[model samples]
Target chain A: MRELLRVAPGGAVDLGAVDPRSTPGLPGREVTGPQRKEWARGQLTLIGAELGRQQEMLFAEAKARQSAARPVGAAAGGGGSDAAAGGAGGRRVLLVLQAMDSGGKDGTVKRVAGAMNPLGLHVRSFGPPTPEELRHDFLWRIRRALPPPGYVGVFNRSHYEDVLVARVESLVPESIWQARYDEINAFEREQADAGVALVKVFLHISYAEQGRRLLERLDEPRKHWKYDPSDVDARARWDDYQAAYAEALGRCGTDAAPWYVVPADRKWYRDWAVAHLLRETFDTLDLGYPPAGFDVRRERERLLGSERTA
Target chain B: MRELLRVAPGGAVDLGAVDPRSTPGLPGREVTGPQRKEWARGQLTLIGAELGRQQEMLFAEAKARQSAARPVGAAAGGGGSDAAAGGAGGRRVLLVLQAMDSGGKDGTVKRVAGAMNPLGLHVRSFGPPTPEELRHDFLWRIRRALPPPGYVGVFNRSHYEDVLVARVESLVPESIWQARYDEINAFEREQADAGVALVKVFLHISYAEQGRRLLERLDEPRKHWKYDPSDVDARARWDDYQAAYAEALGRCGTDAAPWYVVPADRKWYRDWAVAHLLRETFDTLDLGYPPAGFDVRRERERLLGSERTA
Candidate 1:
């Protein structure tokens, strides 16, 4: 199931070639309509429950290992040992979402991530860089928002926007955005070295599906607040965005953090697939509660004795 | 209770004159025995409840006003208007704590801050500067850790160490550490301008109390991990640390963020007093939920439409 969706390190992935309506893990391409959804729904319920349990286990492991710092110079990526210094208590997951407008990035967070504990999850939505953010290296703001140990961090849109949007919109010189692809690969590799389980999800939605979603927003008065007229301006350049995504997924996918191209036209399927993908990512970690370091009996006596009055 | 403990901006504060054993907010200094402990415990409970409630309100207000950015150039320190650009969602409290060895900072956090919502609280303990941190200006690391709007951030020890430890220990020459007192004041004033409410606490423990606490750590087997032999070296220079604290508290206290001398001989009283002090600080912010901007009726209809099937 994971291999079907995963973009192998250094492998070529043509975004235009992938179908947005296809569900890679679900059986029978012939299955359609409500029956298919019912199957997806059942899978989603099971996945959500398992994901929640995994999240709790990770959070518990983090607390138990709070005082333990990672051993200096742990081997980078692909250590056969189950133990990881960065993965110990401080290991975190950064779920980076990149897509064209109306790709349902925010909806995925609301439906899938909202099910998890807010205490262990941090959701940071990135828009245009602020003036202060622009002054630093492209990765500065992104680095600052990376989830601390024991957190599942969701970046609704991420540093990839620099290469994707910057290239498509001609916002920066080609020399710059072109260079960022390698920089991003290197950065993610470093995060993997430091005990970060990195997952990049490119919500691959068709151009026709995007138009429908955008129109729905326009027709609904409540969603009018969310409807940005600029979305139309971006839609005019749909082919450009597709090219940008193809280039990004192809060049940036590495062993440390591979890109997953999820078919996102169906919001329900998108949410379900993301939940499953996340479970697969977390299953890779060898996590557990740290052993008790303090003597409980001796401390109990001291707290109950003269100190209680003193 | 707040005024009794607060050191007014620019007011003369003699650390040597204050009694570490004195409970400033509690009544009847003549009171002793278990009765005094019970009274202190009662006050701590009351203060804890109030502090918890205040933290919730502040967090709620931050969500309500998330979209409302502080108006450009809102008044610094004191402003009569209820609407503040920075205060709309970004108002945060940075509690800077400075003290001598065994002065009970970790205890203060465990007792006082432990009562508040961990979701809204961030505690960063600064130690010797890393090579990367040293490359930047002294305030660089401090600024990065400031709680993003609507958080209560506690600095177990803060930038004041640049002056206090740097001066007494000669980690930096007199020429450098001497200049930081004014630099810190200006830096805090900038935070005030940005809608950050700042408070500085100097946990004032007498030399005799510090010795007792250090002795307790050694005698208790469970606490042996916390006791460092280096603490003895710092203890040897007790008077120098005291003089450094006096200068830091005196010079850095300002209208934007004043320093408070917290009596730390009695652990319960210290926790109760700091909790009370935080409640007073939060009360100053005019905070509430941001008004609902989306049309609830329209959103409900859209959710129920063909999109549910699509």
Candidate 2:
């Protein structure tokens, strides 16, 4: 299953290869050109349906476990119970990104983490640090956003920006930001050793695509409010930003927190790839339905007030 | 149309309400519940559908405008135009609350605003403010969370806490926090006058209900992490918080930003009511399909390429 979903060129598999028509259980057949687009759309629809089904199953199983007064171990995967239906009491996932802006961060979140139970999902979108944050060590803000056990916390532009953006714009001296790469790798290694699963995604988009989007924002009167001309100034530093990304990806791309260089020029492909990554991560946990002997129906009836007057 | 939809408790109407079972233009109808719950659910579903439709229309029209080199207003009120599609700009809404541990603010956001277009939605969950926010007025942290044009922003525990929590906990003196009611009213009034639509919902769950939820958190190992013993200290002051809320709502509930005293003892009811409020608010805007003759097909075709280059 892991090999089948490998991240390919363009940040996603060629949906055409699956040929939905030929692929059993999938919705569409493989075709060429616009049909490929249709095939991708159908696959997404199928994925949505399957996600809904899995969520319902998980919810039901979790409720059953709660009713049964099961031990905490039973809820986690250690007891041969369904891991997907249980909580990660000590498991953590950290998502790191560079500057978010409009470069597909929000879209990536919606597509990838949207299906996760909200209680198990945490999002921390970083901006300029507060006085207190600045006063602390540089990684303090990043450390604070780390997910608790059995949870996934996404950092929309993380501590890496301390090195990437600050270095690119010379906001900090070269000497300070240059040495910070090793510091970051050590920090991430500590987290990984602590049982945190960190996945870093770099959304790579061409300057032309960004400009086109910005232009669309300006052209629409309603969207005119979202337009900030200052973004263009940042765009002008495209090469610098690219170099910074390449360096950061090269330095920090370790087994602990492997970096996925995603071609984000195509929004659909980015969404698909991110969702695939998340599914793969969770699938590895080997989640399943909880053990038998729980009477969920009786508990549900009691909760719904079988004896109460409607 | 409006008269048919409006149901008086016992008054007679000239036209019958649209029958969900028999309506041809509408999709299949699911049983909506009874009384307030029914009203709430129906309104929420309507609002969700309407918002989704209008957002899709806006994006399509915006893309078309970009290609034609025309301002959005030129297409406005016509099919695909902003006005016709209910694409009013510079209208913002914010939801604010106070918190103890395990307050259902996150649940409220997911259930009420879950169907909203992510592009038009922003959520800011406030924690302990930083030195920068503390240096300024109490409202500084909250004021920053207000939505930009054509967007909805929700604040989970907002500026009101400065008065409600602080006054109750004796964190601030009476004279200082007491005067804040007027300050808040003035600020909200300014927002209302500037075309911002604000609805404040107080999730009025009883102390007993809160205790039950808290106990559930402790009993369930997965939720054990959420059980903060410190919340009991705050729970002791439930009456004070209620008194503060009653006074605040009584004083500040205006035509512009009315406060809904939702009976949140029932989570389902609370979710339904919040969604209803949003539906009513957006429905009042009279959003509809964009004006005709936008030639969306042409624009989409252009993007897809008219002929296969390969």
DockQ of each: 0.05, 0.06
True contacts kept of 1: 0.00
Which regions of candidate 1 fall more than 4 Å away from where they truly are? A1-128, A132-140, A144-186, A197-310, B8-12, B26-90, B110-123, B131-145, B148-150, B212-227, B265-268, B293-310
Off by over 4 Å in 2: A1-107, A116-197, A202-252, A261-273, A279-310, B1-46, B52-90, B98-103, B117-120, B127-136, B148-150, B192-195, B283-310
DockQ score for model 2: 0.06
Candidate 2 per-residue C-alpha lDDT over B1-310 given as tens digits, one digit per residue, 9 for 90 to 100: 2121222322222121222122121222554334545555675677666655554443444433332444443321111111111222345566654434455666787666666554345555554444466688988666655664445667666777777666777767899998998898899888887657786766666555666676675455444433333355566666676677656666666666666555556665566656666656666655443332333344433433322233
lDDT tens readout by residue for model 2, A118-192: 433455555445456668888976775566544566776678777766776676789989889889889988888
Q: Which candidate comes out best when scored by DockQ?
A: 2
User: Which prediction has the highest lDDT against the true structure?
Assistant: 1
Docking class of 2: incorrect
Q: Give each prediction's root-mean-square deviation over alpha carbons.
A: 10.8, 11.8
